[model samples]
Target: MESTGGLRERKKLRTRQAISEAAIALFLEHGYDQVSVADIAAAAEVSKRTLFAYFPTKDDLVLHRIADHEIEAARVVRGRGDGEAPLDALHRHLRARLAERDPITGLCDHPQVVAFYRLVTGTPALQSAAARYVASGEEALAAALRETTPGDGRFAEVTAALAAGQILLVQRALAAANQACIARGMSADEREPDALAEADHAFGLLSGGLAPYRR
Candidate 1:
């Protein structure tokens, strides 16, 4: 028999996936604002209450995965190996993500993902909703810095905010580059090499300026 924790986790994952999938399908079909939580729940075969339990809000149906990344970046910084520089750890992780063309890094070529980006970019409500998701990622990075450098006076606080801002800029630049490549007729695969190169360049700039601060 499955442990209670394991069963609960699995059930939660399935419910979240159902809600996200339903929301994406609806957003892709009829635009983001036209779809409602009630519609998403009905489509997913879950009650509105069930959807809220899983997502809290309709914007979350679309922004949940994005929120996960914000938390992940902070964790990566906090968990860097002994003697490893925080920037180095971040660069390594981001490089791996770029190489894999991870969707979170904006390297996705799937029509659905592309459409989703377009939808989010174009819709005022979704754009407004995304502010918190983006801020969460920054906060996570800041928290990681605080955890990693606990006794650095104000260094960690300042550095964390700077690092988060720098990283967010890099993410946005990569997304714009990828979208431009697609607009120029490069297939997602064809665009990834350039995209990764650009990402590496962006990270390199941050790494250079912040190298002295890393411990």
Candidate 2:
């Protein structure tokens, strides 16, 4: 039998999923700004208070998926293989995700995923939330760099900031390009080769520029 803690966690997961699904349906149908947190909570059969307990802001309801990825850059840096350059590790991760057609790679053309892309692109609030996601990734990546580098000075800080910004710029560019392809009705699989090539090019630029300063 599952422990009480396990059961509570499972129940919480179910509630969160229900809330997210209901929120998505309303967001896609009526537009994000037109939908209220009250609307989402009512649709999910939860109280406004309960909904707020899970997601602090209206933006969180739609952008929690982005939150799921907030720590990914830091994880990539810390988990790189022995003898692997950090940018090389990141490049490999990006290539594998694009090849696998991960939705966050911006190559997935599945209906729900496309709807999410549309919702995010079409909503100002969601766009702000997405920006926050990128900002969080940059901070986490910078902290990881500062911790790992030889010194704890401004040089390490500036280098980390620049490197983090460059890596995220590459990711944003790739995501936007792939999203454009999806918008034009190309399947993610059909876009894989071009996307992979672009990933290589972007990372090649980063590796060449950032590797010298990396420790």
Cα lDDT tens digits, model 2, 1-215, are 89999999999999998998999999999998888888899999999998988888888888998787787878988988887767777888888888777888899999899889888888887897788888889999987766667756657788898888888888988998999999999988888889999898887777778964343
- Report residue 169 deviation for candidate 1 (angstroms): 2.1
Model 2: number of backbone collisions: 0
**lDDT for position 170 in model 2:** 83
- Each prediction's RMSD over C-alphas, in Å, is 2.5, 1.6
Stretches off by above 4 angstroms in model 2 are 152-154, 213-215
Error of 1 at 101 (Å): 1.7
TM-score of each: 0.85, 0.94
- Per-residue alpha-carbon lDDT of model 1 for 1-215, expressed as tens digits? 88999999999998889889988999888988788888998999999999999888778788776776767777777787888877778778877886777777677777776777777778888789998877877887777766766577756688768877777767777777787677566777888788778877877788777654354
What is the C-alpha RMSD, rounded to one decimal, of candidate 1?
A: 2.5
Q: Quick one: best TM-score, which candidate?
A: 2
Name the 10 consecutive residues with the lowest summed lDDT in model 2.
206-215
